[model samples]
Target: MDQKTNTVASILFMVTGMATVGVIDNFITYIAVEVSLWQFHFLRSMIAVPAIVGFGLLAGWTLRPLRLWPVLGRNMFLSGAMFVYFGCLGFFPISAVAAGLFTAPVLVMFIDAVWSRRRIGPIRLATACLGFLGTLLVLKPDVGGLGWANLIPVSAGLMYAFGNVATRKWCEGESAVALLWSYMFLMLIFGALGVIYLHVFPGDPSSYLTRGWVWPSASVWMWIAIQAVFSLIGIGFIMKAYLIGEVTYVSIFEYSMLIFASATAWMLFGDRLGALGFVGIGVIIVTGIVIAVRSNAADN
Candidate 1:
């Protein structure tokens, strides 16, 4: 594919990934608030692993160079981020968590500049600051309005953003197949540990293995299985974006997930944002456009 074709393809991949991930994440949020993070993580990963792996093999994915360490590092960070994200979901409004997570692109830019020594130009830096201001407004930082739980999602955003940066800078040359599968594998391990910590180590193991174990409702299982099936494609698209675009640019696509989530929330759950929320959404949209436009110019 030519460069322009590749960029568009990557962006589409990213958008679709985020759109589908909105489904997965909201469903998980729906469930996790009622159950422990351990419960959902185990059930989701138990299903996600086999499904992602089988599909990868069927699609003729190969693991050339086998870079397991970087995969481990990046995905461990992601796993921790997810723990915090879901924990926050259990405590706060879904839109609130989504707003916090949108700070990731700004965080990614700053982290990349600091770690990679990339020069932060005036435009990029200004956009980052503006985006962060929007986040603070949504969060009502001046009021200290959001509780400690809000920190969970924000922390997840930071870690997830940093992981994307690492993916772009250090692991771009790796096989997309390897990166996706390896990250899934890593999540499986982390999820397994979550299960073990909660279930196996229970002073009364029976309570966990039998009593409190999350029995995924039929609908929840369907959601997870569908996610397991589709997220491989989602992750592949994201990996391609990481390879071909700047991390800041591709990461901004995450805000697109927020857009999808907001619409889904309103349609499915009767959720609506207030004035500040709308402002935050507008900032997210505007900054995302700026990032895309500037990145396209640089690409040319």
Candidate 2:
């Protein structure tokens, strides 16, 4: 593929991957029972392992054994982010939880500047402020209620931003497949621990595994399988996009996942947003994309 075609293809791939994440997340939510992150993850790896290995064979990436220390470090933070973010989903709406986690870009821009020992300019600060304002709209934190649920996704976002910084600095030498392999293994470890913790520590743990493990019908399997396939391809696309596009611009499209998720909710689940929520999400998305475009323009 020509460079331009390659760039567009990469962008599309990232968009598809991110968008698929929302569907998988929301669809799982619709399953009428909260899935244990541990069991879900264990199953995810079981399915993803074969698919990823096959993709590697076709792509001709060498199967390299991961270096233990680095993979452990990277996967620790990555799994932490996933665990916190997904846990937030169990308490909040998928799109709302996603918006809260979207704070990663704001965190990234500042974290990057701080790590590089550069001062953030006023304009960037203002844009971040606007974005936060929009996030609050979506979160609508009711201090008196279980509204603190917003914090879960926000914490997840912070960890994710830190992980992104580490990615640029530490994982530069690693192959994309290698990164995925190591992350998968780490995630498996994380899942096992989570399951053990839930089952052993919680007094009413049987209620969990009993919640919804009923035989999944053909439709659930079909959707889940499609989600998995798209996700794997999407991961490759995102890695390629990060290689070609500036990191910040590439990250901006991450917000599109919110838009896609909300739209899917409306169509598939008849989710409706109040006036303020809709307006707020619109502002949040536009601001994010604008920030990305501005950053790209500045780079060019």
Candidate 3:
């Protein structure tokens, strides 16, 4: 595809993928009430991994990584990020979690600057500060009485930034399918370990994160299947978007998830944000766009 066509198609794919993810993730709140976060990951991966392999085979894509250790390292970071991200979904609104996860770009800028000994220019430095301020607004630390739980999603973003850096630095020749599979495999392992740990020394049954495996109700199974299928669809489109479009240009559209998720959550669950929260989200989105635009200019 030409650059123009690629850009347009990528935007469509990204927006659609984000919308799909936003809608499906809201279901996690319902799923969390019935099962542990570990069980959700375990069951979802059980359904998703084989389907990924089947699709890869049909597409004739190479599912093997060019370098195993780097792929595994990347997987470790990405899967850990997802673990935190989804775990927050059970306890926090999707918008807050999305805001926190989207902070990855800012974190990436800082990480790259530190690792490369590059000076952060005034514009980038200002952008980073604005992003941090926006995050505080969205999270509203004072509203809920600040606690460690509030920082969980930001931790996810930090880990996700590391995963992104690893992908660029170490997994250069890896296929998307290979990376996806490794990520899912590690998530499966993490899920299994959590389940085992909880079973051996069980915690509060009412707590989603601490609870052990329970025999899933039929409705819980339904939601798990929905999450598995829809998440794969979303990830596939997102992968395609990055493959065909310039990363800097395409990544900006990812901010659409904030809009999509927030809107869907309000519609589905009446999850309302105050005026300040909306402003914060806007600040973060604009700052992210500025960062992407500057990064693109520097690369060119």
The top-ranked prediction according to TM-score is: 1
CA lDDT scores, all candidates in order: 0.69, 0.64, 0.77
lDDT measured at residue 240 in model 3 versus the true structure, 0 to 100: 62
Tens-digit per-residue lDDT, 24-69, candidate 1: 5666554643345566666666776676567767888776435667
Stretches of candidate 1 off by over 4 Å are: 1-6, 33-35, 134-144, 203-212, 296-300
Q: Which regions in candidate 3 have their CA more than 4 angstroms from the true location?
A: 1-16, 128-143, 239-254, 281-285, 288-300
> All candidates' TM-scores?
0.84, 0.79, 0.84
For this target, which candidate reaches the highest lDDT against the unseen true structure? 3
**What is the clash count for each candidate, in the order shown?**
0, 0, 0
What range of 10 consecutive residues in model 1 has the weakest lDDT sum?
203-212
Report how far off residue 41 is in candidate 1 (Å): 1.9
Position 234, candidate 1: lDDT: 69
Put down candidate 2 lDDT per residue, 63-88, tens digits, no spaces.
46445566567667777888777666
RMSD of each: 3.6, 3.9, 3.2
Q: What's model 2's TM-score? A: 0.79
